[model samples]
Target: MKHTVQRDWRVTRPSRKSRFNFDQTTALGGLTVALFTYIIYHFIYPLISKGLLW
Candidate 1:
């Protein structure tokens, strides 16, 4: 006896524009980096430092 399974697949279509708007992407990336840095310094850095020392 043979059994067959059914599956559904989905594909995402790409945008037609070949060139990216770098200015917006770069600005958003910079903001994200700044926010991540602030959080790490405020919360994570102290914990890591204490772990390393003791």
Candidate 2:
């Protein structure tokens, strides 16, 4: 028995540009930090302060 693959059935991938430049990356990083800080302040900080962080 012989197995063969077709050349026409190729997978194509998307190309990447300079979408993650310094400004964009920095903005995203800052946003992520702010979001994490907000979550900790609203969720974790209260629990810890109330001694319910067990």
Candidate 3:
């Protein structure tokens, strides 16, 4: 008597194609916006409020 093994196709399919990385893109965009806002509020706003930046 002999035995054989079977494999499932679904387990290996994702390796062939990359899934859309929307999560990463969104997180990066949010971080960039936060950084820009922080810079404007902390550095630029202070200068403007003091009537030094023009």
Q: Pick the candidate with the highest TM-score.
A: 3
Top candidate on lDDT is 2
Which lDDT tens digits does candidate 2 get at residues 1-54? 889887785448754567665678899999999999999999999999999997
**Candidate 1 vs 2: which has more TM-score:** 2
- The C-alpha lDDT values of all candidates are 0.80, 0.87, 0.85
Tens-place lDDT per residue, model 3, 1-54, is 678676664665555455755578899999999999999999999999999999
lDDT of 3 at 45: 97
Query: Which ranges of candidate 3 are over 4 A from the true structure?
Result: 1-22
Q: Could you arrange the candidates by TM-score from highest to lowest? A: 3, 2, 1
lDDT of 1 by residue, 1-54 (tens): 778775645446754665765578899999999999999998889989889635
**Model 1 bad stretches (over 4 Å):** 1-22, 52-54
Indicate the residue-level lDDT of 51 in model 2.
96
